[model samples]
Target: MTDDAPRNSGTELQTDWFDTIRINTPAVERRAASLPSRRSLKKEWQAAWLLNAVRCMDLTTLSGDDTEDRVARLCAKARQPIAPDLLDAMGVSGLTTGAVCVYPTMVAAAKRALRGTDIPVASVATGFPAGLMPLNLRLAEIEYARDQGADEIDIVITRAHVLQADWPALYDELRAMRQACGPARMKAILATGDLKSLENVARASHVAMQAGADWIKTSTGKEGVNATLTVSLVMCRAIRDHHDRTGIAVGFKPAGGLKTAKDAIAWQVLMREELGRDWLRPARFRIGASSLLGDLERQISHHVTGRYAAAHRLTMA
Candidate 1:
């Protein structure tokens, strides 16, 4: 983070991206001090392989964009048992128990509908997306999400501070957010696109991990630049480095722009390869995409029928 940079340095913006289909993550420092040994890492990796999931908080807009239809569609999808159909259709053991993530306002409804099922309620809290709000207000939001029965709370760090080279600012904010979330698991979103550089991404990831974030996320999905393999690698390196030192395993989430099954699988593969086996579990990795479910569904349908499904709520775009 840098507070010393001159104004309008294009320092606040990102540039260029991979146009090729191949996947590549940025250079990262490996060897997490807190990570486990080879055997334990294998067990953890095997447990997490191919576990695709969703992140849907803020489906409803912040500027009064109601997500009733979106929620309805998701609820309808959730009500239908997926494992049997998905298993036979995709020729795989079973699809991951994809949770219907939501905001604090909708946590209760998601919890109520998804009850007694594998799907869990997730909420975006603590001034999510743009964490520029007051701290007390953010804490209240976290409390509200938990009180409403959210199993997870994904909060954003202050982009402005992180850009200012203020590591303590980033750390303190996440520490506060994690403390406020109480028993609910906490995910700290880096909004990597806004960070603009691999160095910043690495720094932010390390600070967040150091401050006790359960997971380090890439984007808010509301930005022009969503999660990229470059940022994901940077964060993975951060996780690896932190684990090497502390022996406390952490997680990574490459969210936003993740749409295709190919995309999901590719990221999953990279995470497994880079972090080795230990970081593959649900405890260590995640894909946060609102539209990925339908894409995966279509692909599964294609896998079973030898033809693509006619349509789904969200098809490949």
Candidate 2:
């Protein structure tokens, strides 16, 4: 329940922060390509690792059709995460996802539903999926989400800024967004799928951290591609490098296209090997997924009963 992340101060923009950045595309791709075979578990070990992934998951509902009723149900699922009987059989207690993520408008509904628990409600703000809104409006959106009781604000950065190599503009915008978030932790989404190169991804990661982002996220889940392993390698390495130089830890979230229990473990491995065991915790790492939980529960059920359960056997998460 405790976190090692410190509050980020939106200090004056740092120039020359991205001066020494270099990303070897082929090397990153090679490591990412070999990632799947590198880590594999079965039975008890697989179940245990999936449980850890559940603890670090951000159970999310970001559809346009999301409603208060749906948000309530989602919060209920977040509170329990897995079936009580399954958890009991496994000898686990107090296991929950890292948080529930939703649109800014649903923050209050999520907050009300998650009341009386430590589970935080995270809202995607700053023109989510596309950070093309005016800077003023994006800043206002952060404050609006905060006032509505969002404990965390996921802000998407402008891809154009990175494409143009405009580090100063990106730094100023992220710093301002961090300030706007106030007490709510700020998660800067790089939207790496649109950033076009590993080098751009690394530079954007550094800018986000320097601008006081508590976490650096991979995507908005709306891009053509989201949360690829090669991109994750680039971003996680940036997180490690930042911590090494500045002595500040930044969280990492790989959202979108992560559905299987295997995908969860792959990301878990990436964090553990690249960032260390400390980053494996909910505070430092989160799998931003909704359907992923269903697969995890299904796998856990098989582990417990020695048989696979039909998808319908588990409630829709």
Candidate 3:
């Protein structure tokens, strides 16, 4: 190879860059046309949309003492009743069982309590929040999560492979993880912040869906690389193109760094505008979050009780 020829590492030399990945999407401008008008997006993202999309909250913290008991209680709290403040805002928010997402070690406890309820258990597999580990170890983690009865498994894609534009390797990893999931649904985490470009995000989304991923996620919420509008737009377009071509719909989950009620709505608005109301089902979209629940609770309390609750009261353990 000449000096100007591309230099690739051992693994990079193994992939075929010319292989066909048959996903067809509209031009970028045309894709934008499918999205909601800026005025409409702004209007729909009011406090109302945020409140409605609070059905799923992610309790993904790993460093904890009462792992079992704490996760059990969080799931319990979700089922018993939401604060009237939250209910008033979303109308149907109360009486819903939001999922309890935890690490594999706590998967058993979470699944044990959530077994019969509508509330599902989510386990982070594939070396979670970071996809830097070896393939076998990640597969083992997914199998363990499945055996532990997790209803859903979220796995981070191989960033090294993805960033290197190794679509086939990424697809194989997703398929392998899916096999490890058994009956549990698998979520493919793109860790968008790390991917760094819309084109990469789009290609990753396509490769993930083609590889049997039930959902394509935005971030791990652990790495500082959380979700963003550009990634979401690119992902939604990918989802649309996939459905249009094959009639199989892939879901989207924007995990990490979302805090305010506004944050939730912004994502919802993006989905609502790009994917339409049908994709709004919990199955098709989810906000991978934890703190937003308390924020929603505080807002609900203020709306119903008519008194401003102290931030301290709402931040209860």
Q: Pick by TM-score: which candidate is best?
A: 2
Which ten contiguous residues of candidate 1 have the minimum total lDDT? 1-10
RMSD after CA superposition, every candidate: 10.4, 1.3, 9.0
lDDT of 1 by residue, 1-317 (tens): 01121211111111112111122332232322212232232322322232343322122223245465555556556554243554554445534334556778877776666666655566888677787789889888998998888877889888887788776666677777777777777778889889877777777777777677777889888888988766776678667766676667777878888777556666766676678865545556667765666666665555455677567432321
Q: Residue 241 in candidate 1 has what lDDT?
A: 68
Question: In model 2, where do residues sit more than 4 Å from their true spots?
Answer: 1-4, 10-12
Listed in order, each prediction's TM-score against the native is 0.76, 0.97, 0.81
Better of 2 and 3 by TM-score: 2
Error of 1 at 245 (Å): 1.0
**Residue 315 accuracy (lDDT) in model 1:** 36
Whole-model Cα lDDT of every candidate shown, in order: 0.63, 0.90, 0.69
Model 3 alpha-carbon drift over 4 Å, by segment? 1-48, 64-66, 84-94, 315-317
Residue-by-residue lDDT tens digits, candidate 3, 120-220: 78888887767678899999999988888888889889877777987677877877888888878878898888886667777777777777778889988
- How displaced is residue 252 in candidate 2, in Å? 0.1
In TM-score terms, candidate 1 sits at 0.76
lDDT of 2 at 115: 90
